[model samples]
Target: MRIAYRVETVRAAEQELIARLPDGALMQRAAAGLAAATAGMLGRVYGARVVVLAGSGDNGGDALYAGARLARRGAGVSAVLLAPDRAHPDGLAAFLRAGGRVADDPYDVLAAADLVLDGITGIGGHGGLRPDAVPVARAARGSNALVVAVDLPSGIEADSGEVLGEALHADATVTFGAYKPGLLVDPAHAYTGAVRLVDIGLEPHLPSVPDCEALQHADVAQLLPVPTGESDKYRRGVVGIVAGSARYPGAAVLAVAGALHGGAGAVRYVGPAADDVIARFPETLVSAGPPAKAGRVQAWVVGPGLGDAPGVEEVLAADVPVLVDADGLRGLDPAVVRDRAAPTLLTPHAGEAAALLGVSRAEVESARLRSVRELADRYGATVLLKGSTTLVADPGGRAPVRVNPTGTSWLATAGSGDVLSGLAGSLLAAGLTARDAGSVAAYLHGLSARHAANGAPLTASSVASSLTNAWRDVYA
Candidate 1:
């Protein structure tokens, strides 16, 4: 798992590490890593044109020190001092000693630079770039140089991942000590093109639980359900899907498509579109009656393309893990969902999430982390907020929220969410926790879409068909 901590946690950990080390030792360690990463990016340090955007804080110091190291290695280094007077005394002195001079014109140096190091702001910064630094940031981006950010890209909220205003877009970012929450999430994640972590002996001082985490392939493989010699269809787990309607029978087919590939022994579908589902997957057990009358199921996926069907209440009343999605989310009674005995996972896109939170769609999209957390807390259920950056938040809010790393724009297709609901519900039946099930589902769903698309326009059914390939690739 790739873990990320909040700014406060990172700062506390940094402080603890700083206390034990020599005064300049910690900064030097960070600077050394930064310089090494910069050198690697440049391919050769000698005769390279490097520009450092230096501000008033330790971020600037790291950049300045790294620039000095490059200067000593025969690189033509120039520092654009945003706060010339308040720059790190030792860092500036070293840079000057190494033949690195302050830029008389920032834009001129930036336009011809081979690489640009952004250090105008750090995790402590708020809102956006300072007025005086805006033009320089723009110039650096407008240049042909490969922009690299130190610790974090300037003008992004370190904790919330909000891009309040103009933010530097880095080709790559080298973060020190621990990964910040912003580096892992979006819209801030979009600014940080690629992220590399530099260990500065802060892990031992950091807390065990991070604020956010992204699961890697091996992690997902371990969580996936596997069959044994003693396992039967029922023992393997049965997922009951309550979805589709007379008007939208395709939803049932798509949901069943995903559920069948989710390691479930059997998929029992209960809805008005039973004929459509059965036609597509003859293996599916179909029931047109209420969900209570459906055969025994370990978990239930309710509400995909369900237009005012009576099964919502019936499924909710079932004593099984329930997943609510799509049209089923409309007019949902918070108290009923909150008071349920079984585990509940609510999968909502931005629009649906907005309805649940009584906020606008724009509000939910702009602040995805906050929106997901609030929905989880308010509904007292695990929430999978779907969008560019899918997030799974638990009701307790103590655990680190799971952020999905694998996703493509092709996943925005219609009926994609329906497939996800079924897939996640199956995982729940397979005995993964709500958090694990939701996150794993998202990971597979996104990966499947990418595979199916392969640079072409993808349909929801294609994504669903690609789930088997996705599952195999994870273990491979």
Candidate 2:
């Protein structure tokens, strides 16, 4: 698993690491890594034109020192000092000795540079760029140079991943010490193109638990359910899906498609679209009554296209784990969901989440991490915030939130969420916690969409059909 720490935790760890090393040792280690990464991006750095956007702090010191190294290698390196008087004295002297010159005009140097190092801000930076440095940042962005941000893209909240105002968009970001939460999430994640972590010996100083984590293939593979020789259809677990209606029978079919491949022994579907579901997936156990009368089930997935379905209350009243999505989320009583003893997982897009929280959609989108955590706290349920980045948050807010890294824009198609609900519910039935079910479902759902689309437009059914391939790929 890839983990990310908050800015405060990273700073504490950096302090511990710096104290153990000799004077200027940590800075030299960081600058060497930065210089090497910049050199690799330039391929032949011997005669490349490099420009460093240096600010007032240690972040600026890092850029200046890296620029000095590049200058010594025969590269024409220029430093655009945003805070000239307060620049790092030792770093500036080294840069001058290595044949690096101060830029007469930021825009002119940026326009002709082959590579730009964005050291304008660090993890301590709060809001957007300073007024005096705005034009230089803009010029670097507008230029043809391969923009590389040091540590993080300037103007982003390093801890929250919130881009308050104008932020630098880098083609690549070379972060030092450890990965920050901002680099792993959006809208800051969107500004950070490709991220590469440069370890500066801060691992032993960091806490065991991180603020957020992204699971890899091995982690998901271990979490997936595997049937033993003693396991039977009933022993493996049954997932009951309460979805669809007379008007939208396709929702039931898509949900069943996802559930059939979700490692569950049997899928019991209860809805008005029994005929449509049976026609598509003949293996499904169909029932038209409420979920209480649908026989025994380990978990329940409620409300996909359930328009005015009378079973929502009955399912919510059931003792089994429940996953609520789509139309079922409308007018959902937080008190009722929080009172449940069994695990509950809620999957909502930005609009649904906004409506549930009584906030604007833009608010949820801008601060996704905050929105997910808030929803989890209010509902007392695991919330899977679905959008460009899928986040799974625990209700108690003790564990780190999970950020899904595998996703394609093609998942925005119709009926995609219905499939996800079924898959997650199946996992819950297979004995994973609400947090694991939601996060693993998101990971598989995104990967399946990418496999199905292959850079083309794909329907929700295609994504569902590719789940088996996605599962196999994860294992492989």
Candidate 3:
């Protein structure tokens, strides 16, 4: 599994590695790797015009020393020090001795550079580019040449994946140690185009527990539940869905739409909208009572379009893995959730999240990672906060939080979330842990949305129809 430690953990590992190595060995390793990556981007280091936007920390030192390597290779390299007095003395000397020029007028060389290296900030940075680094970053953005970030894109919160201020948009970023969460999440991820890890022997010291993780193709494939030849229909898994009402009977259909195709052996739907659900999906076994009264099921999905129904209490009290969404979020009590005997996953949008936190929607959106974690802790369940970038956090905090990378903003349409609830619920029924089910379902749901629309406007049914292709992709 790919792991991403927090900044503090990464620093501890770095310090341990640095102390064991000979003098300046760690810096040399980082710089050499950076220089090599830059050369690859430029096609040829010799005679290439390269500019380094150096900061005050080791990040700047990495850039400056890398520039020295380029100078030794006959590249016309220059350093524009943001903090001239605080620049690394050894790096500056090495660059100057290797024929690299130091210019305090930042924009002079950056405007005409063939490539720009952003070393303005590192993982330690909490806010945007310092006032002076702005112009040089802007110049790099406007320039036609390639822009490469030394460690991570400047002006992004390395730990939280939040964009603090105006960030430099990099064509590619060469990161040391391991992948930071910001590089995988959105907003900040948008600024970080492509990320390449430069192995500097830091993995052995990194903590096994990652702060967050992004699923790769192989990882997703492994997590997906596969049916075996020996397994019978009942042995696979059965899902019971408690959703929809007369006013929103379509939600019941959509939820069943996802559940029937989502690898579930059988689906038992219980709600007032049984007629509509049966009309759309006659295969579903519709019950007239609540979920607990419904027949056997490996897992349950509660709340999509439930609309303050009186029977929700019975559904919420079931003794199986349960997924809560939409109307299920209304006036929820932590005590009721905390008392549950099984794992529960709560899926909420910003508005529902804001309601849970008793804060404004903007506050929840502003700090989505924090909000998701707080909600998980407060409700004592797995929380999936849906937005431009969906986040999944487990209440136990054992697994690293998952940030979905494949999603389209067009998925904001009605009934999309209902389908997500069904997909995730079915996965939970199929015997994956709540965390795995939620994240994997979200991955598939987002991919289906992308496939259904392919840049065109799409309805919720169209998204559900495309799930077959997405499932095939995971298996492939």
Which of the two, 2 or 3, has more TM-score? 2
Rank list by lDDT: 2, 1, 3
What's the lDDT for all of these models?
A: 0.92, 0.93, 0.87
Higher-scoring candidate on lDDT, 1 or 3: 1
Mark the regions of model 2 whose C-alpha exceeds 4 Å error after superposition: none
Better of 2 and 3 by lDDT: 2
Provide the clash count, candidate 3.
Answer: 0
Provide backbone clash counts, one per model: 0, 0, 0
Over the stretch 1-476, how does candidate 3's per-residue lDDT look in tens digits?
Answer: 44566788889999999999998899999999999988988998888999998888899999999999999998999898888899888888888998999876767787779999899898899878877778888988998779999899999888777887889999999999888877776667778878888899998998777889877667888988888998866677899998888899889889989887788888899989998888888889999985667889999898998887765577678788889888988999988998998999999999999999999998887677788899999999999999888999998677799988777888989999989989998899989988999999999999889999899888889888898998887777
* Tens-digit per-residue lDDT, 37-114, candidate 1: 999999999999999999998999999999999999999999999999999889999899999999999989999999
- Angstrom error at residue 300, model 1: 0.6
Query: What are the per-residue Cα lDDT tens digits for candidate 2 across 1-476?
Result: 98999988988998898889999999999999999999999999999999999998999999999999999999999999999999988889999999999999888899999999999998899878988889999999999999999999999888898999889999999999888889988889999999998989999999998999999999999999889999998788899999999998999888888888888899999999999998889999999786788899999999899998877778888898999999899999999999999999999999999999999999999999999999999999999999999999997778999999998998999999999999999999999999999999999999999999999999999999999999999999
Worst 10 residues of 1 by lDDT: 309-318
Name model 3 segments beyond 4 Å from true. none
> Which consecutive 10 residues in model 3 have the weakest lDDT in total?
308-317
Measured by TM-score, how close is model 3 to the native structure? 0.94
Rate residue 413 of model 2 by lDDT: 94
